[model samples]
Target: PKSTPAPDRHRPSSAPPAAPAAARVLWKRGDTGRDVRELQARLRQVEWLVDGPTGTYDDLTERAVSGFQGKRGLPRTGRTDTVTWQRLLGMSHEPGKWDLYLMGGQPAAAPDLRCTSGRVLCVSKSSRTLRWMIDGRTVSTMSVRFGSQYTPTREGVFQVYWKSRHHVSTLYDSAMPYAMFFSGGQAVHYSYDFAARGYAGASHGCVNVRDEAAIADLYAQVKTGD
Candidate 1:
């Protein structure tokens, strides 16, 4: 579970969907993932859309894509081709969890069975909430943001293997404070981006906690293992 550079999942470490490559990845209507979410975010930034960034490329997203393409003199395919993505990227910036979930819908997945007993960091995706539970009793709860659709936070039970009070990402040089590593590069950490943007941005693969004080408390309570 310990890591240096390989485990860090910062978006900059890998090419964004809009990055140039020989084989292009196109996002069309019905496609669902972080890429699509990003496309919608960009459309919203350029004022071509104000509907849903539901992480799904629905008809509204399609129309937005087409409209953007047409405005930029590209083909109105309603598909986010590489050229279109690149163009949009030039016009807009990346989005966060709150930005993607602009309407502020909570996640819907329940905690794993492992969380019911023993000390556990209960993360419920369905409600986008994390519960710090000790012996099946809830100690504290806070809103959380997992990774983006592209690099999703993992599921299943994992123990905290390491902890760092202050960690800076090797690849992206982003600061991750109070990081409690449960999986390789992925940890429950305090993200400045999450705090600043709210849900407007997302994590690479880490569980991002916005409340610094809350995460500091949780970090103190959570040891290397239960």
Candidate 2:
């Protein structure tokens, strides 16, 4: 009888992180392929990478993935395994509520949304709350989870860059990233399932609201700096 050949040390170019064979190969040092390209595109959406086309896992991609891994409190192996690959693809297994903790309570004072013309409204993931101002009056309120720790909304001052009533996603099942980018890959949009815990926190760092009215209101009133 002939013995079976050894599994390919190299990973295929199109395997998802959840594939059973993902554990058999090292993806970082491996050559680039369609799989790597997919990863590049997804990473770009979340602002984890700035360069590298969809194809190979080049040095730049490796570095970017490494940095991401480090930031996520994972091993800095740089090699793409099932766990790392899942995160890169935004398909990470849900971490239960116990895994997450809030060190500080919600902001003691509400956020100031008044005259936010030239300022950005930042939401604290740690606090699961949002702060904005209008007419010099502060409005600090709790917000639903739009993404998970793995695919969190970015932090920065972004303009109301774009708007859309009907959006689509190639990776996810629904449309999001609707309007306004506030920095660090975060956005404000519409979705009603924000209360579902881990399952609801699946956006690619985009803030999801409760309905069309909310998004519409934001889209019309918000300006480049507001």
Candidate 3:
């Protein structure tokens, strides 16, 4: 009786436990929060996903996340866990290669432009080039793609009529309209895919450039007739 089974030596202790586990990131599928928003942004940056203004997890985002995960040899859970988030943000062991901001880096400004009021708007649809005149001298000349015969870019004097940080086009949304739309509905816009000079040419009826800021700077240097 005094031994009393040694006070149950094999009994387990319950001392209020250890720290709680971290929360898992839920991507576009039953998730609606800031983390999902970040995931969408990162995915879009890498061209793995399309435009979505909402953070609620949807089927499109789920598919994109799965595709991205498969491409990276991840688990393909379609959920943005810590590992997925890290990979998406370029912080994982195998980071995403594409840099979205690289679109802002243009090769160079047009070198030869004629100085004149309307010369800045001279974009040749046939040659796929643009020419600008300043002070009666050619100041800028560069390769460009004008609209096709079906939707030709209007040939005339256009100004920096409208600037939009998030302009939506008929085919796509979230366009950056740099120089104005002098033609019917066409405008000089920033095209991320235009980084490769003359390699590709596709536009409804507008001029597409690499860097928006560069075009903006060029536009700023000009006047109505300077």
Candidate 4:
């Protein structure tokens, strides 16, 4: 009898089976429910759902979804699929019932203690709002965005050190119109991406104001060393 063949040491062991993909409920036009409402709310947070969450997946919702997918290099199906939902969720906060349904009135967030003073740009990450305050009175307030975890917006008291109209970031190659620099490279500026994508995206290390009119007004009022 022939001797048994030696074990092949160079042979690779069998790999483990791939994990199954999570089963996700696909949402398309005409879909209506809490889930759809949540999706709409998340989209609104990112500024995609400009009209707010309607619970029903209508034409507007479909368009918003398609736009978002296109921007993110998704399938552009204009429908909520697993990949789309996951990407949206990662960039957005959990949708509260009020955020989803708009059943309750939205109240203005109280200014931070540090913001109660002379002319100041009161940026509140908690409420995602920025209040232009003068003598402790709010001149104007608008929705704002902050940088991501890797490039967080600096907190605490800071004065406007510089002002630039129609500025662009040399580091990131992004437009930063109406920029009021407070802390180093970080500034309070108008972000077109924020207006377009909403909370779905973040800045490098700046306070992003979405309302162009509000930022323009603020920029006009703000002075260097203010």
lDDT of 3 by residue, 132-174 (tens): 5644455665545556678776765456555554577766554
Superior candidate under lDDT, 2 versus 4: 4
Worst 10-residue lDDT window, candidate 2: 97-106
1 or 4, greater by TM-score: 4
Worst 10 residues of 4 by lDDT: 98-107
What is candidate 1's local distance difference test score? 0.82
Give the deviation of candidate 3 from the true structure as CA RMSD.
12.4
TM-score of each: 0.54, 0.41, 0.40, 0.60
| Clash count of each predicted structure | 15, 15, 19, 5
lDDT tens digits, residue span 12-70, model 2: 85756664443433477557655665666556556676653436687777877787879
The CA lDDT at 76 in model 4 is 80
- Cand. 3 Cα-lDDT: 0.58
Residue 33 miss distance in model 3 (angstroms): 54
Off by over 4 Å in 1: 1-112
Q: For candidate 3, give the lDDT of residue 89.
A: 68
TM-score of 4: 0.60
Which regions in candidate 4 have their CA more than 4 angstroms from the true location? Answer: 1-39, 42-106
**lDDT (0-100) at residue 83 of candidate 1?**
87
Q: Best candidate, lDDT-wise?
A: 4
